[model samples]
Target: MNNEILPHEEVINDTLNHFSGKFENIFHQDNYDHYRSAIHDTLDLVGTFLHRNDKPFSGIEAKTMKKMVQHIDLNQKLSSYEEVLKEVDEIYVQHATAFHLPQYVAHLNCPIVIPALAGEILVSAINSSQDTYDQSAGGTFMERKLIDWTAERLGYTTESDGVFTAGGSQSNLMGLVMMRDVFSQKNLNHNIKQDGLPPEASRFRIFISDKAHFSNSKNASIMGLGEKSIVKVPTDNEFRMDITMLQKYMKREILLGNIPIGIIATAGTTDFGNVDPLEDIANIAAQHNIWMHVDAAYGCALLLSAKYRHLLNGIEKADSVTIDYHKSFFQPISSSAFIVKNKRELRILKHHADYLNPAEMDEEEIPAQINKSIIQSTRRFDALKLWFTLRMMGQEQLAEYTDRIIDLTKDVAEMITENQEFELLTHTDLSVLVFRYLRSDIEDLNALNLHVKMKLFYSGEILVASTKVDGQFYLKFTFLNPITTTEDVHQILNTIKKHGEDFGTTN
Candidate 1:
């Protein structure tokens, strides 16, 4: 087969030029054939490369990788679209993490479904900005509908409202920002948004579980609350937050004249996947008139799992909540939202911009999404991915997939516990297990575990994550991929043992 372009390529180029420039034709359907051909060819190459290299990941040395990247110059131009696609295939496609692979039991990444994949293509093609109604049209309504649906599932009040955000981190920032402003207004008659934080801002505090995601402290810092403002409540043996300890800390802070502004209850912590006791935490926050926020980024999948929904029993009581569909709902990254129990609370983040959402539009009886969200002036249409997935496959099917992964986690934990060389750190709370290898005659087990993890990572045969627990390194298995089977688990276990034994023998 000839590799050159068609003999009629010049005619096609002339016709394309007659319409407009390349950028202008992209938005018009008249040039869809040209666009479709390029997309089809690119995706075909990606699929073929992935099929050939089924391993989850591979690592290249820093020096070698840097040299390879330096070889590509921005000023250099490729001859044809085929050459561009081939270059991309070699540089990125072969090395990108294959979350679909069963051996890739690493982070909270999920294997995306077909419907969402299709939605992703449509989203990129249309390039809708969901920040305002005029910019996104139906996309604005679609996002709000998904948020309302999610609120209903969590059993929140009918007055609840939410906005799609980049991820859990930004959502957490929004929740805390609201808490800070609202607390200032209610207690000190201060508007932080207008007059800025009070001199006593340093005295304001937010209570959170010891196992909560690091975003709490980071958001506190970003909001000018300072890192010292975060008070981590102790966790029980199961890693769930201790309700009594939280109450004690809150009371002590109050006695010291520090106003407790918010309480963050984590539903599925990053490393352990353990959930805080939401009911108890909610009651404590109510007693103190504090804003209650639940970080359910990892555990939100339980809301869809009919059999496991009770795991997040008191999540609805939260004044605000953060849920990452990307993490738990098996959607692609950048799919998440921050929800509030009362729609009026969203006013704290609202601003009127004449160029975007003007006051005149509100006076003329118009609605725009920019009035709600705290971030993103030009946001991508991500809600379409979830909407299409739910409409095509149904929530029930997704729930079934979630339950399967949870069950797989439990089985894998048992296998690790039964092994003599392996030490299971904590019980399966959601779908994460942090464990390390501990051979009877081995010394410096931490170093051994680290070496084993890096060895497997460099080998590119399988991929998994590692974390530190109580100052010791342990491997982590986050079973978000439903395709990861018992056999895959056994193979990974065998690989870990082999690596550990070899390291011990060599070192």
Candidate 2:
């Protein structure tokens, strides 16, 4: 080759050296000080943002935000940490929705506990993959302990076992998976894991309340069953699953030569926060030899509540249960679990990977969390968040927060009922209120309510949600923050009233 190095070769060498130097930021022991400094700076920024944020939203329009984001050039050279942080603050933190605010009574989102946030820091820094014991070591056992604790709270026996999931949707999917496989194996002698769904899968049906989460229909579709596989039982006046209607549906479906595979009961429905008749549904499921799954994603907080725990009375009878710690438990996003009454049910999801978790490892008594999981391979250490919350705050304190929210909902419902301009739809069993602004002079009530919601969102003073009930639009308030007082509700209602009046006067 040439005695002198070529220009392109020199350029390549320079680039290689630069890339190698970047390894200093790879979070090794040698970069501990650098890591600590960066984390401290980031935390300080976040703390300041939280303290300064006054509104739930910045009221920035979608087109405006999109244009702001589009102006940034991702292909540009790397900038200093300070420059990057400044841009992030302007684009994200400034306009971010403040779920922690008392005015942000819109969705199922909750203001997370401090301990869980601390746990999240450790989880991201350590980056323990909860797939196999060798990958996570002590984290594996720690997660299992939390699962056991949750199972106990759910009144599940020692034989019960579960795995952490992303959220309610994934947890609900796992429950349906178990229901599908167990029914297939027992009735059709088909191993869904090995041979795929049986021919009779089309005939299989799941029963859910009309007000149940949309995940039931989605999960059925995901499992090779059509959307028609889900039969929505009508709800009563209180928006709870009517037990008689459910029984009638089951009999009718069977009469039509369709097999009732499972019942997915909602504990704390999304809009009304009303729980289905769990005990009655459990009895029906047992009588029919069908699986019973409780999607307690929202109301699982009742597991710890001393006063409202009875609302989840027959949850113990469920073959599987889904719990979202992120919702009522006040944990961060993507913290949820799917538990089964029998540990043996998890065997259906087991598989062997020679380089990862081989079959021989099981014989050697190695604990691998992948054995119980279906969709996930490399999973986050989300269980630690719940573990920290329980250890630092204790279950009693958490339950008190739950009780406060439930009590608060009742107070707000009464307030809405007293307001002549407002119409209360249903008295919730949990912390959700559904109501609508009413005006006899307004010919289009739906259009008026919709306009009010949009105006409030654009005004940025308050953040509330809206949903359609029986083809009529209604405003929804989901109280997850214990700090949100009756005064906050009063202010929120006044804002809505003001908007409604503005619409009436303008239109």
The best candidate in terms of TM-score:
2
The global Cα lDDT (0 to 1) of model 1 is: 0.87
lDDT of 2: 0.91
Question: Could you give me the TM-score of model 1 versus the true structure?
Answer: 0.94
Q: List the residue pairs that clash in candidate 1.
A: none
Clashes per model (N, Cα, C within 3 A) = 0, 0
What is the C-alpha local distance difference test score of each model?
0.87, 0.91
| lDDT string, candidate 1, 84-164, tens digits | 888887777777778889988888888888898889998998899987777888898899899999999999877999989
lDDT of 2 by residue, 314-357 (tens): 99999999999999899999899999999998898898999888
Model 1 residue 178 lDDT score: 88
Question: Candidate 2 at 174: error in angstroms?
Answer: 0.7
Candidate 2 backbone overlaps, count: 0
lDDT of 1 at 44: 93
